[model samples]
Target: MVAGLLGAVGGGWLVTRMRLFPALLLLGLCQALVNLGYIWLVHSGPNVGVMAAVVSAEYFFSGLGSTAFVVLVTALCNVRYSATQFALLSALAAVGRVFLGPIAAWLVPQVGWSEFFVITALSALPGLLLVVALRGAIDRAERARVH
Candidate 1:
């Protein structure tokens, strides 16, 4: 947890030098570390009950985080598209949850704990790339907004 916090601070500093979209992408990559920690804790020789508790906590925190993200996304959307875009974003989040269980099941057994975490961390790379790719557009759009 200490290391994760430090990484977040460092990443945030580094990201500040980047344009908006890329910074958001790096934010996603940094956020993925939270999942890595949960995976580590679950696989760290804890008993089933303890593991379940940890898992529950993780999910609870995740839902909180998702709510925050959704709020932010909603805030970022144009007024004209607010309802439709927010609905779409919420739907995508639901789809992500649906796929998560299967993905975890498939990867956890095959790669074990350590490798599984590495892969989970790697999963954020595309979001980082998306931010990079969309940086200019994001900046322009944001700058043009009335807000």
Candidate 2:
């Protein structure tokens, strides 16, 4: 709960201070770091402090990352098709979670906790790359919204 609240606060700050793509990139990076923290938590072995810190970081980043996603979705929606588009995008996000669960479960045992989380953490890279790749488009869209 505390971590979530922190993430909410961080996300709100990001929304106000930065453009959508930059904010999403930052949030995505934070998410990847948080996954690394998970590997540390798993290896630390019975250390409550490590567990708390990792869980907190995880919750904070995940919530903030989710908020970024929602913001991006909102930015992308066309008013004419917003209802359906938003629903579809949001559902796809939910499906992503579902899809990852089994993959994570299966991989964790096969590759070990550290490697699994590392792979999961690195998964953020593609989106970050896309953000960079589509910077011009994102900027134009935001500019269009303003003017």
Q: In TM-score terms, which candidate is top?
A: 2
For model 1, the stretches where C-alpha displacement exceeds 4 angstroms are: 1-23, 39-43, 47-72
Q: Tens digits of per-residue lDDT for model 2 on 1-147?
A: 988988987897787788877888888898887888987888889999999998888998888988877777777889799899999999987887888888888888899988988998889898799889988887777766667
lDDT (Cα, tens digit) per residue for candidate 1, span 6-32: 444554455445545544654565466
In the predicted model 2, the residue pairs found to clash are none
For all candidates in order, the CA lDDT equals 0.61, 0.84
lDDT of 2: 0.84
Give RMSD (Å) of candidate 2 vs. truth.
1.6
Query: Which candidate leads the pack in lDDT?
Result: 2
- Please list the residue runs of candidate 2 whose C-alpha ends up more than 4 Å from where it truly belongs after superposition: none
User: lDDT (0-100) at residue 84 of candidate 2?
Assistant: 98
- State the lDDT at 2 in candidate 1: 42
Where is model 2 poorest over a 10-residue stretch in terms of lDDT? 138-147
